[model samples]
Target: MKAFILDHYKKKGPLRFGDMSEPEVGDDDVLVQVHAAGLNLLDSKIRDGEFKPILPYRPPFILGHDMAGTVIRVGSNVRRFKLGDEIYARPRDGRIGTFAQLIAVNEADVALKPSNLSMEEAASIPLVALTAWQVLVEAAALKKGQKILIHAGSGGVGSFAIQLAKHLGATVATTTSTANIELVKSLGADVIIDYKKQDFETLLTGYDVVLNSLDGDTLQKSLNILKPGGKLISISGPPDPDFAREQGLNWFLRQLLRLLSLKIRRKARRHRVTYAFLFMRANGDQLSKIATLIEDGIIRPVMDKIFPFAAVNEALAYIETGRSRGKVVVKMR
Candidate 1:
């Protein structure tokens, strides 16, 4: 099968496109024929070896995280789906390889694609939607009438989060450039902070939660806008000790993570708010609920661009610019 292989980890490294061996499906896995895949900053970070310490994908592996495809075959133990099922997923961290003609995803991570969406649109939802779900819905337990600030409102996760937060009845505020103000507004953001023109900290205060997907500086600033007992969750992170423990790292790595996050954690403590890192996991059940929301028109997919499969490198470059208004997808067919 033709696939893009990462021969080594280098900043702005190019993935080698070539034929590779087919995947061996486990009893709980489904072999999928790739139709489209989504591009994310996480993909670039992994390619640049930023996640080497935690994820540690050795050289010469395929690199991709989000995908929408058709199940061509299901393992004997996979009863939820069968051949010809249209599905989408962010395959579990260790098993991700969606930048290919095919992939074998565990049945537990796969969900039926929303009937209202195309393969490209479906491909864009899993990673970003799951991130928003994990942050606001699962972690924060955001409630109606509460206020939440979401950074990078026009970006993938931010776009999804603004809508989801509004759906959850929280007042949504977000930061973006002038060009994207209307875009975020259409996504149901109640307050728009033009980061280029205004300082969000001056204009906002006493928020229930703040979802940070920006730089360390932005992460630090986010803590101030929240009131006492507010949750400050970051997906771009100096991951906290809890994450290290969840990954079951050794004591050395655990203490290292503690040291890395110590300053921000201390600041959070002083402000009477809680700070934590969010690393989203794959769950078909959550995706199923997200699909229903999509079908019901409560949430819509925000699409930026779709590249041909051959132009995946170009797609990655575009995403790295951090200027895209929404999700960037690579269509395989």
Candidate 2:
């Protein structure tokens, strides 16, 4: 199969289009005919070896994780789907190679595509939507009438986070530049803070949860807006120590994570709140729920741009600008 291959990890490395072996399906996996793939910062980070510690991928590996397509073949163990089923998945790291013409994925990680969206739009939702769903709905268990402050409201995760929070009846407060405030507003953000002009930390308080996806400084500042027992969930670096220890990482890794968490925990305690990192897991059940919401017309997919499959690198470069209103996608089929 012809796929975009990553031969090396470099800051500005390019993806070369070439033929790669077709994936062999496992008894628990299904082979999908690629229709479209979503471009995410994770894709770029993995390409450049930025996530070596958390998600290590060796060189000469195919890249990409977010994808939507049809099931060309299904494993005997897969009972939930059949051949020709329209599905999507955010594949596990080291196993993802959605940039290719086909991908074999675990049935547990794949869900039916939302009826309301096209393949391109469905491709855009998995990674970001799952991140938002897990952090707000699963981890935080946000309640109606509660408030959530979502940073970068116009970005991929933020856009979905805002809408989902609102869907759960939470009051959504989001930060975006003046240019994109309208965009965030359309996505159901109740309060919009122009990040350039307003300091959200100073103006907002009593938030039930802070959905953070930015720098360490911003992470620390997010604690201030929460109520006494509120929680702060960060998807970025620096995992919370308590959770890290519970994960039982190696001694060396645990120690390193401990050092990073000390400062975060201190701030959280000082503000009378909880802090934790959210690494979204791929669950077919949860994704199917999200797809149902989309099919009901309660949520919509937002995409900033679409590049042909061969222009995968160009799409990555465009996303690196961090100015996209929504997802950047790659058309594969």
Clashes of 1: 0
Instruction: For model 2, state the Cα shift of residue 57 in Å.
Output: 1.7
Write the residue-wise lDDT of candidate 2 on 162-279 in tens digits.
9899999999999999999889989999999998999999999989999999999999889888999999999986876655665556778778888887898888888889888887
lDDT tens digits, residue span 118-155, model 1: 99999999999999999998899999999999999999
Off by over 4 Å in 1: none
- Model 2: residue 169 alpha-carbon error in angstroms: 0.8
* Cα lDDT, model 2, residue 161: 90
The best candidate by lDDT is: 1
**TM-score of each prediction:** 0.99, 0.97
